[model samples]
Target: MIIGICGSPRKQATEYVLEQALATLREKGYETTLWSVHGKWVDYCTHCDYCLTNKECVVQDDLQELYALLTGAQGIIFASPVYNGGVSAQTKAVMDRMRAVVAADKNFFKGKVGMGIVTGGDRNGGQEFALMQIHTFFIINGMIPVGGGFFGANLGATFWSKDTLDGVKLDEEGFRSLKKTTKRFAEYIERYGVKDGGKQS
Candidate 1:
């Protein structure tokens, strides 16, 4: 199954692109699901080492469900809006909490394929840096990270704030290209892909 972990609120391009990615995955006979962590007050980690052994978080919040999604999916498509050259706080918190997954199983994220999409406010903006933040997590977690024929495909070069904030319009044209990249990535991972330094369960 292919799962999308979206950390954006409202119906932004993340939702649209993620939906399209899932649709394409479905067309390819792959089951898919979407999980959004929008508007939720997910707190940051407290520098605790609880997850390194408990296989879960000490705090009770959205992370409980997120941990299951992370471990159960065959592939993960993660998306977030670039905020000051990085992922949003909510997204970071969720990713940060992944320590629990690591603590539960040393190789918990092994062999899981990951794709990160970041929306930028302007052209050639912090796209790469923003993606790096998420891709770094995948790298350290032993997940295979895929990009647009490179290492991190741009969801688009830029985003129109007016259209984005309104949620009435999305980068459909950009998503069309991104859809191709995402589809090809999904297939590659499914057919002949494995997580870096990890194994498939």
Candidate 2:
């Protein structure tokens, strides 16, 4: 299964593009799930070091479910709206709270295929930086990161939403990038299967 995580808080461009990305994967014979962080309760990591010993987070919330989905999936597509030249707080929270899941099993994310998508309000709204941030998390967790190779999609998928869903729909280049990224993602997973389940159970 491939899981697409949408870090947007609204039913806007970010979520729309992510849904399309998952649809593309589904059409390619991959079972895909869209996990949106919108309106979900996910606490920020407090650097308490609780999970380091207990092997779990001290606070319980929606993230508990995400942990399972992430580890069990063959691939992960982390999609976020660019915020201050980076991922949104919701997306970062998901990335940060993974410490507990990783603490429980250090290799849970090892060998998994991961990629990123970023939507921005402006043409040069640091979309690439936000995309890179997601890749950094994937690398730190031992997952293999994939991008859209060259040309238009050199940094995975990126959309200039212009702060509106309709605007994103009009982004021809963005759709092309999404197509390239998802095509590569599906092909990579099909050709070189993941090395681990990354599951806790």
Candidate 3:
């Protein structure tokens, strides 16, 4: 299944964009699920190393369920809203908490495909930097990172929401970029398949 993770604390523009991307995946006949972190309690890693021997997070939060979803997903889309020129604290917390799974298995994300989507208040509101941070996480975790292409989404799908849902709806180029990225992600999954539960399926 394809998993779209919305890292936005608010359920507005960021959620809308992620839903649109998931809709495109569904249109292409891919099984998809949307995981929203709006109210999820994903705590940051304390580097306690408890997971190193236990193979699970000691914090015992919502991330336990998220880890299962992540492990089972063939493709993943991480979407976040720009906050002070970077990803929101909620998004960063999710990424940081992923260390529990990573500690369990060094290549936990191996062969999985990942894409990024970012929403900004302005046309050039640090979208690229946010994408880079997400892409870096995917790479360090051993997942393949996919970009939108050579055009509007050379990094990833970026939306200028102008800090509002209605403004996001008005960004035609942003919508197009998201659609194109979704298409590419689906195609890649179909052609190459994914590794689930540490095995390629």
Estimate the TM-score of every prediction: 0.84, 0.96, 0.95
Tens-place lDDT digits, model 3, residues 1-201: 888889998899999999998888888877888898888887888888898999889998887888888787888889999988888888888999888888887877877888999999989989989999999998998777888788777888999998999999999999888877877777767666474534552
Tens digits of per-residue lDDT, candidate 1, 110-196, equal 878787777766544576687788779888988777666633344322232333644314555455556656766676686655533
Please give the lDDT score at residue 28 for candidate 1. Answer: 80
| Candidate maximizing TM-score | 2
| Model 3 ranges with Cα > 4 A deviation | 195-201
TM-score, prediction 2 = 0.96
Total clashes for model 2: 0
Clashing pairs in 1: 111-195, 148-153
lDDT against true structure, model 1: 0.69
Question: What's the lDDT for all of these models?
Answer: 0.69, 0.90, 0.86
Question: Model 1 RMSD to the real structure?
Answer: 3.4
Which digits, one per residue and each the tens of the lDDT, describe model 2 over residues 84-171? 9999999999999999988999888887888899999998999999999999999999888889989889879999999999999999
Specify the poorest-scoring 10-residue window by lDDT in model 1: 154-163
* Highest lDDT scorer: 2
Candidate 1 lDDT score at position 62:
73
In angstroms, the error of model 3 at 141 is: 0.9
